[model samples]
Target: MNQKIKRTATKSVTGVLLSIIIFSFSGVHLPVLDSTADSYFKESITKAGVSYGVCRIINATVSVIKESSLEVEPAGIGLSLAIGQIVDPINDMVERLSNVLVMSITSLGVQELVYEISVTLVPSIMAVVLLLLSLLVWLENDRLVKVQNVLINILIIASIARFCLPISSIANQFLQEHFFEDKIVKANAELARGTVDLGQLNDVQLPKYDGIIGTIENGTSYLKQKTIDFKKAIEITIENNGLIIETLLRLTFLYLGIFIIQVLVLPLLIFWFMIKIVNILFTSAALTAV
Candidate 1:
């Protein structure tokens, strides 16, 4: 009778060990798969937002330059001429880069993949099943098994929904820290300087043709025409600067959208689904007891 009892206890211990091994192996893989699958969503959001804002700025500058017509002080003509010469090609480069960044993000199919996997609730469902099956196999006491199963199911669901893919959060933090420090901060300082300098355009003195030249007015008319070109150039430059500010604003909004989706909306939806799963498991267990 003692030997018989020992054998039964040994069988239960073996079953429990087997269940733990299986649970550990399965549990480990779910988080890995989730992180791998969701990485593209994070990457695409960052790239698309930053690139889109840059492109908008370039496009606005090009449009302003093309449409502008005004007169300014004769001394400003050289500055205007230089800007006119360089802006078109720069615009083209920016436009091409923007198109490439956009296409690259779109081609990744992040939203579609995430949507499909989420709709199926594949990972969370698999976790629940694994927990229940493991408990049922390992536990000798029926009442203890039911309680363990419920606890394990809830725990697994919570872990998958809330704690899976902490790498996503880490990556986001890295992006914000590095991008702001290296790119945005310096760009903002330069923009401020440019803004101040542009605002001081009143300091430029127009050429005042003296007596003989003023009376003859041969090249005076030409100088006056050149002054008109200078004004248009100044207008275009100011417009371009405004576009830069607009671009920064747009980029900010894009970042905000990305933050909402990844940090808030996505996680909340996942958590809600997990709660639903827990409730269902509890209800089923209660009915089984009845």
Candidate 2:
């Protein structure tokens, strides 16, 4: 009699819980969660856009340097060639960063789409149907127990898949805000400043020679001043080269960090944890049913 009463109480509780699950999935929306997810999605999109813009600026600066005839002759014969060697790798890196940013934006867009679909009537209806079927099987005999377990597992997976991306976005956003935001901002600023300085170097023009008569008239002083100018130009080129390389490295690492966190690491971790939870829930449910 005690066992019977306990079984009755367990069934009653399970029924109530199943009813609540069905109702939650019956086209009901949680405004707060949706709004928060939307906010995070927008913030991610904005950051990606800014990063891509910075990448374009870097590319443009590199292009200007590559196209300019910035030769400091005599003492700086291979100065432009050296700058080119330094910039070529950075150009490749910027191109790769742009591609990654584009992919990040696309992934965010896909996540938003998935979030929208998950909240709509279709998936909600499917979930409601699945819950009802599982509840019915729960009340029935053990003949269809395997089918019931399969349905439960499917529901669990579907639930996880439906909500994982939005939750991952929230997690990613929190990490970026607390950890990477300052570093990203500083790196972007440094890249911008470095690019501007690099572009200015292209404006350093070669001295114009008037004629042989005018050249002979100011020959000694002209040679001395020209040599000084050439040396100064070389120094500026070396300084800018160092600045560009350092900032480029910083920006590259920053971008890699963002990409890994937002796209790869967080999502995989969240999905794995969700799967673990599903396994625990499934095992407990099976044990209770037995």
Candidate 3:
């Protein structure tokens, strides 16, 4: 009789406390957590935009180089073919990178939408109703215990679903700040420099003479100057090829890291851990009841 009384009191207290918490949570927005998530989401969008912009600029520069013929000889020897060979692969990679950025942005937007819906009053009220049902089942005989467990499970899942993304977003932002910030900055810098270099390469043009005699009079000087300019352009292109390739690799790795953490790894891990904790708690409660 005394054990039964103690269990009843404990259940009552737990139910009241949970009810208060649920009511409070439903009535109020968690400003700190919400703001943090919003800030992180905005920052992620900005980064993706900047990356996309840089990629477009590079693509445009490469397109210009590929389309414009750089005649280095009178007999139709041009560097456009060589530029195309060098740039076609890089352009393809840039297009893929742009796609990835778009996907990342979309992922972030979806996450934000889910989070907004989860934290709204309707979900909170539903969770509260589930909690109340679980409490009522708790007060009943052991025959209804399984029903109570199901209600509790649903409640736990609802809670986790409501809050997991915001927590994960906070953690993702923290991880990015600690691990990826410096490297991303460096990668952006290198990409910007490479863009400028490619633009300069595109600007290198061979001087034109008026007519054949003028061409003949200045042919020697013209050939020498044009040769020097063409050689310089080739040198710039070769140098920029390695730099741009390295920078793109760095950006790809960094973005992949962010995507994995923000979209996949952290949220899944948190969800699994929360579910595990719920199972353990329920198992303990069951054992106590037995």
Candidate 1 local lDDT, 1-290, one digit each (tens): 69866765676566556545544444343455545545645555665655666456556645555433123324345664555554555466556556554654564354435444543454455445554554454446878777866756655664454443343444444555565334544544454454444333334334543567574665768667756755664665656556555544544554454456555565567557657776888799899999
Which pairs of residues collide in model 3? none
Cα TM-score per model: 0.41, 0.74, 0.83
Could you report the Cα RMSD, in angstroms, for every candidate shown?
12.6, 4.9, 3.7
lDDT of each: 0.52, 0.71, 0.77
The candidate that wins on TM-score is: 3
Q: Order of all candidates by TM-score, from best down to worst?
A: 3, 2, 1
**How much lDDT does candidate 1 score?**
0.52
Query: Between 1 and 2, whose TM-score is larger?
Result: 2
Better of 2 and 3 by TM-score: 3
| Candidate 3 Cα errors over 4 Å, as ranges | 1-28, 70-75, 121-128, 131-147, 207-214
| lDDT string, candidate 2, 1-290, tens digits | 69866775676567556656665765455576666778888887897789789889889888887666454443344655666776787788788778877887888787777777777644564556465563564355685776766666667776776667778877877887898778878867877777776676576554555576866787687677866765675576567667666765676676677777777788789989999987888689889999
